[model samples]
Target: MDIVFDTQQEAADFYRRMPSSFRQVTGVMLINSRLAVFPQKTADYREFAQLITRYIIEKYEKKWIMFIIEKYYYFTDAEEKVTILNIVAAIFSGEKDDLPHTGTLQDRHETIMASLEGVLKEHNTFSFQSIIRFRLTAYREVLRQYVEIAIDEYKLEQEYQVFVDKLRRIVHAYKPLCEKIEVYDEHPFKLFDEHHRLIRNVQSVRSFYPLLKQWGIEAEPSIILSLIALAPKQVIVYTDRPEHGMMKTLHRVFEERVCFARRTLHLGNGSDYSG
Candidate 1:
């Protein structure tokens, strides 16, 4: 069986990296600008296909991904393409730690292996590039879908950064209403003054309402609005779920001004202060 690849360099590299046992059973030689692989034994065809498939996945997957991103999606920005590629890798590896909905990376290896094995079985001589272009339609489509997902994620990330930047500006410029504040991450969310007295009245929140409206920041949760409104110099947040979305937003917006505490906030007399 003979497998022809587009570039002599790739063919030579593949041949050079093959195991000695496999090399003994196969012949690799350059033909013009292309390279051809010849398996001495018919029994080695399956192994050869597997080797080639693995090589493509390991070395050429990123290149193909970039190609798809540029050719189909028209993303010309190098940094943007790189970010999307990283996202694709993360999706494939199932390392999207917080995204459990993106589905598993099952069958990707088996799918490509099966496609290559099929090509090898049907043809004695086939161009690897042609197989990738014409034979791997399903695989390429899957890659396109992954790219779409990555692009969506990238846009969401960009929007989040913008939102965070706006909040950061607001936090940085505003004067602190108090020296310190403690926040309890409960259902309704609670805030306490530096004296550990619960701030129950809406007066402080009301005071910041106009600023929030003026800055077009009314979409944020009330707790975030309250915190930003108060703009405390130091914020101590008590929450067991620090990985929660709201907590992350607080950390991003406040930076060094925010600290997390796992224990609950103990208020004096548990009474609400109108102040």
Candidate 2:
């Protein structure tokens, strides 16, 4: 079996990184500036195909992703392109979880491996570039889907940053209604005064509703609205789930004013506070 590369460097790289077991059975040579791998034993063809499949996935996958991004999408800002690429990398590496329309990187690898193995079995010598361009349609489609997901994620991240910036501006401009407030994270979220007395009259929060509406921000959670209305100089939240979405928003908006205590809050009657 023979596998050919377009560039001598790529050929050298594939040959250099070949496992010792495979290296013992294969010989590499340069032909017309292209590298070709020739395995001595015909029985080792399957193993050689598997090795090439892995090499393509591990070394050349990112280059394919870059090609897809550049060919299909146009971004004026270089940084935006870089950001999208980073998101694609995260998704491909399985660092980003629970993606909607894509399989795990391992799944993609297996799919490509199966396709490549099928092609390798039928052909004794093939150009690696031609194989990718003509035979890997399914793999390319998967990559395009990944690029789309990355673009979507990048847009959401940009919108989130804008929202956070607007909230920070609002928080900075608003006067404090109280010196401090205690928040207990619950279904509805419980608010307490500085003395740990439950605050029942959150109707005061309605006054700030119109201000947010004027800025095209509306229908936010009541806890978030109340916190904005109160605009306390300090906010101490008692919750084990500091990574909650609401907590992240509060921390982003309040910056130095928010503190988190990672423990459940128990009221005096031995019942957990419920809002």
Candidate 3:
């Protein structure tokens, strides 16, 4: 029999109390089921539109049906590869939950308050904002790499090859000629692509979460990709929670390049970042 809970805690407690078989079922669902946000209006529509346009002609679109929850759909496609990628992108794009960060109501309440204040406020007195910004900058680098990878995959796909090739040429040709590409002193040149009026055609895209998720990376790898993209000379890890798997991965990946700094920090900003 299926069970429902009014509160998430109720559900968690139920799972914790379950027999091993039931617990295994829960694990399978979490791992195999593609997560989706409810209240369909919140799902990234731009990504949905793109997914339809990209794969509708592939002739296998009907293999799996979209698991609908109200207006939102999870696992729009049946293919495992495509589905995993979409989930990854959606999670990174903040379209879905961060399973690792899930916690009690107290943690959520604190996060909500912090988010409400907006971490990067111009008037805030938080001394740790600089560190947060630095961390964010590193994350952006990782996103950029994934963005590139997604584009490359599109270009290589047989169905998308012609369109991708044409777009690539246009982008390359427009590169030298477009005087509109704004160059930021501190940020990567790719970030400016959105600001150009000529790219307005592409700018209408509100979400690439589905496309980005296709990479099948967890939270830390996503962050690490962003760090690599930024290519910082030095990095300091500031945190109150030592359980983050990404930090451990960083110790092994970057070795001496990364170090920990004990700081009293609060979660900030739940806003979804653009790719």
Candidate 4:
């Protein structure tokens, strides 16, 4: 869903309007994704680890097929949507596997709340210390997700158009998501695109893959999809994978194609593109 805040403050105001709980859930989801990137000894799941390894071997062709199965959803199919709507009330009346994944992130909201409460038995602080301690890891994670998507030029040609199309729709369809404003004792933070650096260096694919795997991250295709959704696919999907990123990838892949048509891309300022 596209949610464009008129201003950074407007976005913060919208987040505040949501039931305080939903925001918390979003925070948890984002945090959990972060943890998945660089697992902690205390939190790592051996089984999940093996799954990830096997997932890598599989070349991640699953494509979230189960999501489609569970959703029984197709964006272009209105009749199927109507069928799901018709069964909404009686969905619970089903046999076993019909249930959803009961992972901690799901079907345990109340229990998680209780667990968080037990851990948060401090001064109800939300102090700078508390914020950093609880949130820095995840905030950095958000940045990393942005980075992973922004670089990796190899996949741009394969995916930029799809992403640009998606972003165009999302940005166009975006509406102000929040209407309620909360009185925050601590000033909220904002996201700035200029804050990110773009990558352009690369010579060959072999050199690129090792560098990418070394980021100590599992670069999922969904990341590619997100890059497509957020920026130009041509900006990513570089023909040669050296050390690159989402935008760099597009530059490599599409710069040639569009450049042929005299549509050269300008990959601008970003962090020091280094290992």
Output the lDDT of residue 237, model 4. Answer: 29
Model 1 pairs in collision: none
lDDT (tens digit, per residue) of candidate 3 on 126-163? 32223233323433333333333433443345434343
lDDT of 2 by residue, 162-257 (tens): 878887888898788688888888767878876677877666776777888887675665676688788889999888888978789889989999
Candidate 4 ranges beyond 4 A from true positions: 1-16, 20-121, 132-134, 153-155, 158-275
- The TM-score between candidate 1 and the true structure equals 0.81
lDDT of each: 0.77, 0.75, 0.34, 0.30
lDDT of 1 by residue, 184-235 (tens): 8887787888887888786766776677667666564468777887779999
Best-performing candidate as measured by lDDT: 1
Worst 10 residues of 2 by lDDT: 266-275
TM-score against truth, every candidate: 0.81, 0.84, 0.19, 0.18
The best candidate by TM-score is 2
Candidate 4 similarity to native, TM-score: 0.18
| Model 3 segments more than 4 A misplaced | 1-221, 265-275
| Candidate 4 lDDT tens digits, 1-275 | 12222345533443444444433433322221121122223223232223323322233112222223234333235543333332321222232223333121222223223323323333222222232245334323332332222222213523555544443453234342222111111122111122234322223223433433443333443333232223332221212223435434433333432211221233334464231
Question: Which model, 1 or 2, shows the larger lDDT?
Answer: 1
Q: Which regions in candidate 2 have their CA more than 4 angstroms from the true location?
A: 25-46, 103-106, 269-275
lDDT of 3 at 38: 19
Q: Assess candidate 4 and give its lDDT.
A: 0.30
Worst 10 residues of 3 by lDDT: 30-39
User: Which candidate, 1 or 3, would have the higher TM-score against the true structure?
Assistant: 1
